[model samples]
Target chain A: MLKAIKGIPLYLLALFLFIVTGLPFLIMFLTSFKGQMEFMTSPWSFPESFSLDNYKLLAELQFFGYFANSLVVSVVSVIIVILIAAMASYPLARLKFRLNRPIFILFMVGMMIPIHTTLVPIFILTNKMGLYDSLFGLIGPYIAFALPISIVIFTQFMRDIPKELEESAKMDGCSHLRLFWSIIFPLLTPAVATVAIYNFIHIWNEFIFALVLTNSTQNATLPIGLREFYGEFSVNIPGIMAALTLGSLPLLLVYFIAQEKIVTGLAAGSVKG
Target chain B: MSRLQEISLDTVHVRKKKKNKDTWVIIGFIAPAFIIYGVYVIYSIFMTFYYSTFDWTGIDANMVFVGLDNYIQLFQDDVFWTSIQNNFLLVIASLLTQLPVGLIMALLLFSPIKGMRLFRSVYFMPFLMSTVAIGILFIFIYEGNYGLLNAILEGIGLESLQTAWIGKESTAIWAVIATVCWQFAPFYMILFRATMVGIPEELYEAADIDGASGWQRFKSITLPLLKPIIITSAILSVIGSLKYFDLIYVMTGGGPNNSTELMATYMYKQTFTNFNMGYGSSISFSMFIIAFIVTVFILLGDRSTRGNG
Candidate 1:
């Protein structure tokens, strides 16, 4: 009992942070279920009754279209990033070449360059390529910005792969492509998961590129779509809350389901740098 | 002797041919990522600089070469200066708040406190939610009249402290800064927690044998070991704070008298909102330079400290 008393302050601090971090989400979630009248009448109180009206309103407003756009963009970009970044990492991790060090440094430097710095030129390039205001336009820049870190993670993982596997394959006359496909690439499951999760989260939540490169509602990703909801539904606070809740749901759901994968993946991705 | 020399020459020629083949293979592997990264990142950086010299609005072909005039004007622009100041202020505020708060939270996870799994899951949830959602949610939370923050203050008998948190110039930046900390501190917590978990158990056992207290153990062993990750987190926070957008843009649009205007937000308004593409490029390029310089400086300082230690 005395030891438990000594632990009270620790529990208090933990609970305080819990409320600080978790309360806003609770309020957002609970407020999402209240009717407009209830929300306006007593904003902090528990909802008198959980209503699906706000969610139904979102459904009528084509909310799922934004989800599809975000899904397509994130999936396509992550797949391409994994394939090419892993391919590039094979040579970078194992090969001896004149430009290897310089190339690696160049990609690493991309991490520090502000995305805003590349904004104007990419906008122009997208326009000139006739890809402006389209989902396809967002993919190019997404793949580009994701390469640096993806390569970093991939190369770090690849270096640990045993050389004996490659040497034996080479003795069987396996070409570099075949060697990579048969040996190196197969050994990269953990790294691929890490890259995919890290990039998926970033691209799914990406704002500036989507905001700039795509202008139409059909092409708008979730972050931009949520902002659009905010503008149109400003007076409808509960409805807006519902949109925010639904918008945040997919990622929160994924995080809960695969909590360890994401936590370790993100840590691995960043701690390497 | 001649036959031996012939064999040696033949082997050398074959090896050279293999080296050439390997070069082709390497290029083949690297070309796709390099092309994409080049056009979007490297090429865009140079183009940003090139466009900064022009007087063209992004919509039209009427490009007038301004020859560094935009940068010169940026130097004199009051809003630009204010935005720069705010960005630095964010950097400092984030370092001070996010890192320490993250450390405290991570430490609490390892404490004898109950229900830590639940605590950790909730702690990390804020980070998973999109930043735009956080910004919009907090907008209402900071809303003056019916906002949760004000209501809570009133409920707790702190009615005088309540106001439109983001509506006033004085409180706006700090309010957004607090929100920023809320969203990101958990990320740093994960980083610190991962490092802390890797710390060997024997060190604490050794400390206990010497009668060291909890704070003393943390100070002597944990803090010293945490130095590398702390530096890395600081670098990330500083660069992220400098280039911050989206949340600030969504929440305030850098408003209530432009109090929270970051470089990125200001650049967005200038280029996209006002069609000052040339000037916006300058601001963004300046951001690039500032981020680059700070990263290099931190890395160098980190390297030198490592050398001394």
Candidate 2:
């Protein structure tokens, strides 16, 4: 009975979680293929015509502007995040500085604070700096926000790098920079991969920063683009569904492909708890 | 003896030279990050307050002091109170749901299962999707007609459970709560499992030698070892829920007579929507205060627990 109980739950949970996670996506995909009447009548049922009409229609609308903006912001932000975080993590982690832990803790504290409290200030500062409407506005906050975890993870990996290895490099007349670039970097692949996946998904899914920072459709990210389907009074359900499917598909592909590292990254990202 | 003094002097000279050289290198590495992060954190916090005191519209700087008025209004406002209540409820619901579900899921994953690698990724998929999409997804799921939730309930002949999930004043909060729980459970599940996996297998062996039942062993060994992680997760949950806005904003928009107005959403409404920027800043100030206090409480709790043990 005990064995049966344990056995039953895993199976049931697996099924429940699978359907729960997969169903919304499935609905979006199917709804995009079906006509309005079919969606209204039988959303759960499969499409009768199997047409690409919805995609073609949305494409004609040139929703691709929003799509391109999203891709650029997420891609650029991810790249910048990886570069800045990788560069910043080194000295804090490896060097013998007095302020290492405290400086890290300060950033960690910054991480712990919610973005809402910081938004007003960011808005004011960015407006003053004339970056409000620019895509580059997010570069600063994105770096600040993503840096703590990236540093923490990188630092953990660095600390774990055997001291003897560094000492050996030192004995061989290598400068610290040379040691970091060659010996330390090549070995930190897993953690770096982990940080990249973590940063990519976060910047991809983020909405608040995107919403406040960008006003025009050309500057907006995918999440804001989807909001166009929602008006003050009414909602265009089918259109929004299509846009959501398009918006989330890239991350979903990444998620499905490189899932384990993403999971570890997500785990580490939230482990401040 | 003369040779020894010469060696000591040589060592001191090398140490001074190395320290002098490394100081510049350290400054090079540390200065840029310090300036950027410092301005972002310290300046932004002050900006929240400065924005709170002004009556200027967003763009132009026609600033006027509404000193203490925003605070007074916030104190008197029913919506603000409701928002605070909602945030507390959110914190409770998160603890209630994320803790057990995450722990159970973690336990199941930890239990020598196959295909967990795939399942772990699958569980995290919703998390990758934007909260906006998830909010939209749950909205349809909770719609009055043709919703998956209602359909499933009606199909099972539990028609009483088929009432409007997000539509009514009564059920909107629960609907939002479910959405929050669904998205975040995987996060805690991973955290708990990671810490759980780090516990030595030998402890379990020792427990078995003492004729400890599975439940007993878990209670005695696992719970004690996992206290730190559990506390950490609880603090995270508290803070996350306290400041939760995006999901609530998208799902219900804190609507149907504002049943779901979380603190963060309320603040957003005041500052941006109502143009009461000062009042919003007051709320943001309070928000900062609440966050600091809550964090302090959790840290103190961590200290006491470790001290007791």
Candidate 3:
């Protein structure tokens, strides 16, 4: 009886936190299906009837196009960042070279830089290169910014693997490229997953660069599109909420599926630092 | 020659060739990341510094340089100062709220509890959602008319307390900070929990044997061991709040007279919205410097704490 009584406080506290954290999302989700009258009259109440009109309206507004744009940019950037950062990190971790330390430090600099610091120059440079308003323009900066931490995470992960595997592969007449592909790259799967999720989430949710680099509807990522959607549909609360839900649905799905990886990836960055 | 000597001679030659090849291979591997990061991020930082010396509006490259003029103007700018102040306020608020609340959540969830995974995920939902979505959700909750918050306040018979949360000058920054705190507290909770799990069970068992109260055990064992992560989270929070932009940008746009203006949003407005590229670049560089200095300062504090320990 005493133990049961003691457990009550913890349960209550947990329940309080769960509601405090989850209420906004719950409200957003529920209200997305709510009609104008339902939302206006009973803001805190559940909808009397579930409605698909808001989602339909959002679909008509080319919400899927923005979703696709975000996917392409985020996926492509994640791929490029993981590949190049992993490749660079391998040498920094395992090899002895004159510039290795300096190069690693250079990548670390990216972690410290406020993205705004580089925005104007990168904007001008991308525009000059004729990459402005293109997905590729966003990719370049995304890959660049994602590199430092990806490299750090990958390098730290790589340094821990036993050197014997690589040396044996070398002694077997396996070329460096062959060894990396066959031996090292395979061992780096965990690190790759961490870097992949980290970059994907960041790039997927990123707004500033997407906002600055792309101007056309075809090029706009989810965040930018959702912003415009909100602006246009401000009066249509349900419609705006539908658009916001669509924008967030993909990432939330990824998070749920890879909860451990997502949590560890995020914690890894800070803990390692 | 013996077989061993013959193989050794051949191996030496091959090793030298491989060494030479390895150098090129390393260079090849590092080049892609280096070139892209160099040209875009690193070089852009330098460009920001260079542009800070000029008076160009970013429309054309051909403009006269007025060295330090933008920096001087930035120093005198009240909005700029206000933005810096807000950033510090955010840093303080994050340190005070996110850390403690997160630590409490971590401690409560640390033990074997019912539906721990569910609770964990629920707590972290805010952190997982896109900032834009979170911002939009908060905007609705903070909406003056037919908003959730006002509704709740009214439901609890606090109708007089309901006001424009994000529209009023007095409550605007605090409202945004509350939203930010809500969004990020889970991050520290997860982080601290991860660290707390690594803590061995024997210490807790021994403390329990000693009849140490839960708070006593937490204060003596958990807080002391959690110090490193605590420092790290503090630094992360401070640096993050310093560079924070997205949610605040979406929700407030640093509005109601720029009450919630942050260094990042100010830089964005100056460069993109106002076309004061030079002055904007100056602000950006200053942000970079401030982020760097604050990170190093926190790290130094961590070092001092470690020394004492």
- Measured with C-alpha atoms, the lDDT of residue B145 in candidate 1 is 90
Cα lDDT tens digits for candidate 1, B75-127: 99999999999999999999999999999999888887779999999999988
> Fraction of true contacts kept, per model?
0.74, 0.45, 0.71
Q: How do these models rank on DockQ, best leading? A: 1, 3, 2
TM-scores for chain A over all candidates? 0.97, 0.89, 0.95
Candidate 1 lDDT, tens digit per residue, A1-273?
112235878899899999999999899889899887887788889998898999999999989999999999999999999999999988999999989999999999999999999999999999999999999999999999999999999999988888898998899999999999988887899899999998998999999999999999988999999999999998889899999999999999999999998998898888886
Q: Please tell me which predicted candidate would have the highest TM-score against the true structure.
A: 1
Q: Which stretches of candidate 2 lie over 4 Å from their true place?
A: A1-6, A171-173, A232-236, B1-14, B110-121, B197-214
Q: For candidate 3, give the docking quality class from DockQ.
A: medium
Q: What is the TM-score of chain B in candidate 3?
A: 0.91
- Residue pairs with colliding backbones in model 1 are none
| Candidate 2 docking band | medium
Q: Which should have the higher lDDT, number 1 or number 3?
A: 1
DockQ, all models: 0.64, 0.50, 0.59
The C-alpha stretches of model 1 lying farther than 4 A from their native spots are: A1-5
DockQ of model 3 vs. true complex:
0.59
The lDDT of each candidate is 0.93, 0.77, 0.87
| Candidate 2 global lDDT | 0.77
lDDT of 2 by residue, A50-146 (tens): 7776667668765788777767777786676666566567777778878878877876776567788888888777877999877888767776677
Indicate the residue-level lDDT of B121 in model 2: 66
Query: For residues B42-149, what per-residue lDDT tens digits would candidate 3 score against the true structure?
Result: 899899899899888999767779999888999899999999999999989999999999987887776556897898888888877778888988998998977788
**Model 1 deviation from native, Cα RMSD in Å:** 1.6
